[model samples]
Target: MPLLAGAATVVAVVGAVLALADVDSPLRGPFTLFFLLAAPSVAIAAALRGLDPFGRLLASVAGAITVDMLVAQGMLAVHRWSVRGGIAAVTALSSVLLLLVVVRRLRGRTASRRTS
Candidate 1:
């Protein structure tokens, strides 16, 4: 998971830098999607492997959503919103959902153990 997170971070940084440098490139769209989407998913996945799962999940979700919203609003303000923005939002939300599932599973296991 840590390896995945590191890879995702590197990808996100590269994408973000590329997008910042050339906003009109065809590749920018996909890279932006990757940066905006995969980074948080990686963070959440890594967090699930540690303690304080709920806190980490919430922090990841909040940070991801904040970043996504800021980028979306910035693009919208500049009248540059596009399908890529939608893709980013969906991807981030999906990642958050995945994290929620992991958290729920962990909670269930703990509860079952306590009851047993």
Candidate 2:
């Protein structure tokens, strides 16, 4: 799980940089998608870590897609459909999700330490 999160973080960073650089190439779209999806995918996977491998995979993909659609819809409704806006929104959402996971893990560790 930690490894997955790390890889997702790397992909997100690379994708964001590529998007912001305005790279005019065939890779831009795919990288942008990776940037948008990677964090959410990690977050969802982390949150569902107890599930069987196949179930976890399915849930993570569905959750990530749901998050992506919601973000895009929100942007469309508010008329803020620009590359910067999209990047910012995806980053913000991913950050929040990752933070939640980190906080939960910290709390779990602290509680275990206290019990020990």
Highest TM-score against the true fold, candidate: 2
Q: Give the whole-model CA lDDT for all candidates, comma-separated.
A: 0.69, 0.82
* Clash count per candidate: 0, 0
Model 2: weakest 10-residue lDDT segment is 5-14
Candidate 2 TM-score versus the reference = 0.84
lDDT of 2 by residue, 6-92 (tens): 876776687788888887877778877887777677778888878998999889888888988998899899988888777888778
Return the clash pairs for model 1, or none.
none
Report the error of model 1 at residue 115, Å: 41
In model 2, what is the error at residue 87, expressed in angstroms?
1.7
Residue-level lDDT tens digits of model 1 in 43-97: 5556555648677777776766776777678778899897655555556565676
Model 1 stretches with alpha carbons more than 4 Å out: 23-27, 37-51, 71-116
